[model samples]
Target: MVSRQAGLLLAALVALAGVSVVGGEVVDAPPTLTVENDGDTTYRVTAYTVESVEDALLTNFRVTTPAGENRLVTYSQLVWPAGYRNVTVTDSVPSQQVTVPPNEAVETEIRVWEPGDVTIYIIEEPDDETHVWSDMKACTERQQEHSIRLRDGYEGGGSTCASDLDLLFR
Candidate 1:
């Protein structure tokens, strides 16, 4: 009877909504950050600005690439303390263009262009946003990172990224 009751409890928990799983710790889904390159090159770039604890842009820190490549991207460099909170986080990326391989998701890194306390959030490509963002704990942190490569003549792609709940409430 005890075993049966435990199974039932597990089923009840599974039925609940808004549960996510991340790094073995259950958390809500993260937001999606999307980007596109509409120029004539083999690489592309996207930029996002992380907000300060007051939900305003923190201008103290500057973002740049250590590598000399013109294709380097510094999407996330601003950092924040663990307990830091912000009700709103806004992102801005100026329009740019480039070319990429056809139907491939490339792997790359965005280091700290400027040193600061900011959380890095990269958008996921070719994923089910609805299912991923479902209220489940097993889906919090991303398991792997990948980005879609636009083929010649392809227009654009849509993606999203989720933020920690602490930031949402702040």
Candidate 2:
């Protein structure tokens, strides 16, 4: 009877959640993107940022790999025509990107270092204090209008959805 209910629903998903189905597909539920360097400085990514909270900082694209490769990029989200809308426009995602092998209930692993190029900003906001104002300023009289609206050009869907991912640290 339908292969005995698909073999009792794949043996109750391999005895409850230790799933590893074959042919029916579910080998460890893959959908990954794990990059770890653990020091020895090699990060040559130069791009990867997707953490927005209603204001901006969402889309920025450009990927023409093949001049020495390093590719790993994926983004799908963009549909926030807020307030009174009638949208059905397809093609423009970034509502909240970056979740490759990283979804601790929607990502949050802050790490920042400077000296040009090595960006991996993916913090699906909600840690409060209005999009995490640096140095943890709970409130300081509007902290200069929230640091001048967090340095003005907050960057949302810029390039209207470019695309990138060159996280190479080998």
Candidate 3:
């Protein structure tokens, strides 16, 4: 005959096993894409995946304005895990371009079900032509290194533009 303590221990072990089986594996949170504007001029930031993979998943595209407003850019859906989505600045007066005013910031967050890379473009539309101010590539392996802050007409993290300017000014 088993002791009462042994019976309770066995019941606890069985319960833990059941719970583990029911819960399965825990999923990781999707990666994030953040863009900060610290320059005097306004900009429109856009992000999109580079290449679409067959087994990859992309969903929950959200765009947050500088004024603390949250808006849904895309519905929760699966798409080829590669391609660029022009992130519209929701706070701008003109709807055609999402504008980030001076000293303001914007962010685009999406749920990435697969591992891939993305490209973010900082564009300026002064006239009919759209000029690309800066662009940075982001991947899962380098997600933390991807946050870009545009300050004094230069993007952070040792961008080539900064180097070029340094050489030109010297």
Question: Candidate 3, residue 29: CA error in Å?
Answer: 3.0
Cα RMSD for predicted model 1: 14.1
The CA-based lDDT of model 2 is what? 0.25
When sorted by TM-score, best at the front, the candidate numbers are: 3, 1, 2
Instruction: Indicate the residue-level lDDT of 68 in model 3.
Output: 45
lDDT of 1: 0.30
**Which sections of candidate 3 miss by over 4 Å?**
1-28, 52-98, 111-114, 120-122, 126-129, 141-145, 158-170
- Model 3 Cα shift for residue 142 (angstroms): 8.9
Candidate 2 vs 3: which has more lDDT: 3
**Predicted model with the maximum lDDT:** 3
Clash totals, every prediction:
30, 11, 6
What digit string (tens of lDDT, one per residue) describes model 3 on residues 2-93? Answer: 79889788557545433222345422223354557777776664444433322112323443433445454432221211222333433211
- The list of candidate 2 runs beyond 4 A from truth reads 1-6, 12-17, 20-30, 40-91, 94-170
Provide the lDDT at 28 for model 3.
28
Worst 10 residues of 3 by lDDT: 75-84
Per-residue accuracy of model 1 over 52-118 as CA lDDT, tens digit each: 3232233231222223222221222233211111111233422222223334344443222121222
